[model samples]
Structure formats: C-alpha cells, structure tokens
Target: MTKEITIDDLKMYRALVETGSVLGKNTVLNIISHAGEAAETILRKQNAIDTLDRIITQQCQAALDATGLHHLIDEDGDGDWSAVWEGLQELADQKRHAERNADTYQKLYEQRAESLEQAERERDEWRGKYDESETARIFGEAQQERVRALHSPEPARYYGTDLNPNRQHDCAGCGEGWAWPCGTIRALDGDPNAAV
Candidate 1:
C-alpha cells in the first residue's frame, strides 16, 4: 500500500525538475517537467473546488440543524438542495399549524368573553328586579298602615320616616305620606333649626 501524492507534492517535484542542471537528456527532462506542471495545476484547481464544496455543505447542514430538520438530510449525506427545500417545507408547515391553533384559541377566547358579558348583564337585570320588588314591599306595608289608620275611630296619622327604631324623629319635610328619604336630607340641611 502507498500514500497518494497531492498537488503540492507534484508542484514541488516540477520545481526541482525545472531548476536542476544535472540532467543530461534535456528533451526528456523538459517532457517530465511539463507533464508534472500540468498535473499540478489541474489537481490544485480541483482541490480548491472540493474544499469550497465542503465549506458550503457545512454551512447548509448547520442551518438545517438549527431548524431541527436534520432528518431531512439525504441518505448519502451529500449537500443536496432538494433536502434543504424539504426542510424549509417542514418549517413552513409548522408555521401554518401554529397560526391555525392561534386563530382557534382567539375565537374561543372571544366566545368565552361574550358569554361572561352576557351572564353579567343577566345577573345585573335580576338584581335590579329584586331591588324593585323589595322597594314595592316596603311601600305596600306603609300603604296598608295608612289604610288601617283611616278606618280606625281613634286614628294615628302616618308620619314619613324610616322604620328604624333608634331614629324616632319623623321627616317633617315629606309630611304624612309614603315617601323615601329623598328630599329630607336636603330640606334638613337647608333649615339650620330642623333636627336631622
């Protein structure tokens, strides 16, 4: 077994043949020298192209690996553009899948928000109805008392006031009527002499 000669070795041999003066056969020496020079030039150019190809392949492989598409590399391990294209296609598909999922989630979020808003609106309406019913119950009780007083021989007139036992002062501003403490505060504030 022998080690193969490289372009640099051939070039060094050619230089020695050209510079050496010990050669007796000028013609034979010229022939060998020219052949060596030609081989060296061709081999050098070819080696340069091979090195460039290896660099490009490394760069391409690095890029593909970053995208997590190393499996797309061909069986021969060559730098084939078709393999790179396949990796790119996989990336595009992944991007599209993510976009679709985002759109679906956005729609779901919007639907949930609308549902929550509707529920809140309904709850507010029910609360308002409950408040109205309670107000009506209070007014109905006051009206019943007024009616009972009118029927009694010894009648006690209805005084406008809240039903709290602690506050015995009736609202003189509202007089004898079923009235909320609406104007009483303002009326009391206006009259300095009046008790709140």
Candidate 2:
C-alpha cells in the first residue's frame, strides 16, 4: 500500500540508521535507502519549481521591456500587468491618431500630384495650340506675299525693231523675252508645264 512520508520522517529514519539503533540491520538499511530516495525526489521537484518561477519572471520582464512599459513594473521587480494594460491603451490611441494623420497627408499628396499633372497637361495643350496658330500665321503671310508678287505691276520697257527685233515682247518684270504670259505668272497660276 502507498503512504505519504514527510521530510521529518525521512530525517528521523536517517538519524536512527546513523546512531546504530536496535532495529534489524536490513530494516534500517531499507529505511535509510527510502529516505535518500525521498530527499532526491524532493530536491528535483524544488529545482523544477525554481526553474519554472525564474522562467516566468524573465518572461514578464521581457514583456514589460518590449512594450516600453517597464515603468509599470512594481517595486518588487514584478510586473503590474494592469498598469501595463493602461499604457498599451494609450500607445494604441497614439498609433491610431498617427495613422489617421498619415492617411490624410497621403490623400493631400495624391491630390496635389494630380493637380500638378492636370496643370501640366493643360499647359501642354495650350502650347500645342499656340504653336499651330503661329505656324498658320507664318504660312498665311507667305501666301499673301506670293499673291502680291503675282499681281504686282511691272515697269514698261521699249524695244525698237532695228535695235532688238527678237526681244520685242520681253517681260519687263524678269527681263525674259517671253510673250504676254510669263513663266513666273503661269507657274503662280497653277500651270504644271510652266517653268518656274
């Protein structure tokens, strides 16, 4: 049958064995052996408990340090977890406010970038229209000069039959001895076969 034995009982058995008591030799040896075994078991259990307690303390300290809440640790070097909870709540509030500000700044940045891009596009469009209008204005002036040249009056020239019979009807404008219609006039009139 199994029975509980205390440290006191084990110590008493060990003392009796050491004192050479009247108990039978085999019985004293058995009690001494059982006492040693019980002491070893108790020591092992106490070591395990100490190790577990140290691990728990270290974990609590690490938690406090990681959360920036080390101030919440009590005077005895134990964590006041409820105070840490309050500190965490304040940290969470600050984080939420920072995130909201970041989101608002991000939105403003996007809007500003979009507005800049739109302004650039509009500026480019206006530049293109201005370039087209300037080109058209230059082309119209050139066309007007061409039309004025075609209709300009030429100075009259007289060629006597005896002095210059072959050039009797020369064009006074270009000095070309052609008929009434000259090459310059014919070319301006859209005649493909006319010489420029």
Candidate 3:
C-alpha cells in the first residue's frame, strides 16, 4: 500500500489542537494576573512617596514662617515667597543628594532596622501570612501543571503536536490525508532525513 488517510486520524489531530488552545489561553491569563498585582504594589509605594513629599512641603513652609525668612524675603509685603521658595528648593535638593550618597553600610543598617521595626509592629504575624500565601501559590502552580498534564490530549500518535513544537508535520492538513505527511509540510523540505 502506497498511502492512505482516515477519519480517526483527523479526530486525534483535532483533539490535540483543542488542548493546546486551552493551555495557551490559561497561561496567558496567569501571566497577566501576576503582572497586574505587581503593578498595584508599585503604585501603592508611589502614592506613599507622594504623601511623604507633601508632608515635607508643609514642614518646609512652617520652618520658613517661624524662622522669619518669610518676612525678610517678603515681596507681597507679607512674606518673602520667592526667596523662601528658592531656599526650600535648595534644601530639598540637598536632602535628595544626601539620600543618594548615603553610605551603603549605613543605608543597609537603616533598612534592616526599619524592616525589623515593621516586623515587630506586625507582631511577626505579617511574615507568617506571607509564608502561607507563598506556600499556597507554589502548590497551586503544581496543581495547575498536574491538571494540564492529565487533561491535555496526548500528541498525535502518527506525527507531532503543539507541545512537541519541532515535530515534523504539515502546517495545513490535506483533504482526507493519512499517515505520510503531505501538502506543504514544513519539515518535508527542511528535515534532516529529507533529500539534501
């Protein structure tokens, strides 16, 4: 017998295609969800930083008023707003520079101290919650893989599948084709065993 195709083969191919589509969709959703959560965390920290800036501004204003600099640079015949603004700007710039140039060891010590302080504030319970969540995520991923493996249709017996990406096969199925790959098979021309 030269070659022949059958209906059973087509059914197998269709099942494999369907399974791959499901896996791709689910994996994409998982990645997008993770990214969204991380983005929210970053935004929360950014908002805190903005609040800190506002507090610093108010404090600077109060300092200027109390030091009589506001009166000395008074242009509105009320307060020296321009000089106050300039001097405050200079002070803010210096503070930012100092923060950037902070000694690594000193900064590390401060960071550890702050983290320790926070941990204490939470009574060590916050880390426990984090540990539980991490454990859950790890197991959830394992369960997902198990479900996919158990549910995803096995590769087409005769040739390849979506999971076996490099398997030799035709991209487009022929009209009632069979075992031997036919019609625009990518691997046919490029395959190592094919005519060189």
Candidate 4:
C-alpha cells in the first residue's frame, strides 16, 4: 500500500515555499506542483483500492458457500468471479429483451385488432348501403307497375240477362275485321275469313 498524503504535508510544503528566498521561490513552487501531481495520483489509486475493498467485503459477507471462498473464486485458486457476474448480467439482459418483445407483440396485436374491426365496420356500412339501394330499386319497380295498371284499359265485360251486342265483334275496338265498325259486311267480302 502506498503512503497517504495529508493536509500536514501541504502545510509543510507551503511553509517551505514562503520561507524560501526570491531566487529559490520558483524551484520551491515547481517542487510543490510536482507534489500536488503525486497527491492526485495517490488519491486516484486510493479510491480504486477503497472500491475494491468494499466489493470484497460485501462478497465475503454475502457468500453463498459455507467456506466464503467458493463463491468469490474458482477451483483453480484464481480471482475469477467474472463468470458468475457475467451470467447474472446476461440473465438480466435476457429478461429485459423478453419484456420488450412482449410489449412489441402486444402492440402489434392491438393494431391488427383495430384494423380488423375497422374493416368489419366498413363492410357492414357497405352492406347497409347496398340493402338500401336494393329496397329503393324494388320500390321503384312497384311504382312503375302501379302506373301501368292505372293507364291500361280493362277488358270489356257484360253481365248475364243483358246480351252483349258487341260479343260477336271480337275485334271491335280496332276495326281490323271486314265486318267491323257495324258488322254489316258479309263473309264474302274482301276478307273471307273475317268472322273466324
């Protein structure tokens, strides 16, 4: 272990620099600067040493083995706790990766569900529009049938006990027969088969 520099060392160095003559002040100041650098290096090394000591102490206190040595080292008697710590870190990383994958899959499922729902809604809307158009088309055809029925003339009819005079005139309305208009023409007219 290296010796720890103290505030007393700094005080002594300062006193030496102040008591030095004007010509030696520069040399003393240079020496003090070098000492400061050395102190900084020592402080860094001490910090590292303190950190390692704390880790070793904690590892020994929390040792899994009854001997308090197997958990801290390997079978070859070397300082190799890297495998255990690395394995633990890998497990933690894997857990985080799985969680991230699960979250991504859940979001994808939600998005697909929303898309399917939207498609179903659009299909239903289109079906409704088609049904309405079909109904309108049927209604329009019914209206046309009603108009035709109202405009077309009905076939003329006569009740019993009142003989129909125009019964012999099958083609009465349209004078296409030879004895048409008044049924006065004989069968030997220009059209011989007029009565049949």
Ordered by lDDT, highest first, the candidates read 2, 1, 4, 3
Q: Lowest-scoring 10 consecutive residues by lDDT in candidate 1?
A: 151-160
Record all residue pairs in model 3 with backbone atoms less than 3 Å apart, i.e. clashing. 5-178, 73-80, 74-79, 74-80
Question: Model 1 Cα RMSD, Å?
Answer: 13.8
Per-candidate TM equals 0.36, 0.41, 0.26, 0.35
Candidate 1: list runs displaced more than 4 Å.
1-63, 71-81, 138-196
CA lDDT, every model vs. true structure: 0.66, 0.74, 0.60, 0.63
Assess the local accuracy of residue 62 in candidate 1 as a C-alpha lDDT between 0 and 100.
74
Please give, for residues 50-163, the per-residue lDDT of candidate 1 as tens digits: 999999877777767757666656667754667676677788898999999999999999999999999999999999999999999999878756644433122124323354
Better of 3 and 4 by lDDT: 4
Best-performing candidate as measured by TM-score: 2
Residue 158 CA displacement from its true place in model 3, Å: 99
Error of 1 at 174 (Å): 27
Residues 55-116 of candidate 3 have per-residue lDDT tens digits of 97677667686545765644434555667767777778888888777776688989999999
Residue 184: error of model 3 in Å?
Answer: 99
Which residue pairs show backbone clashes in model 1? none
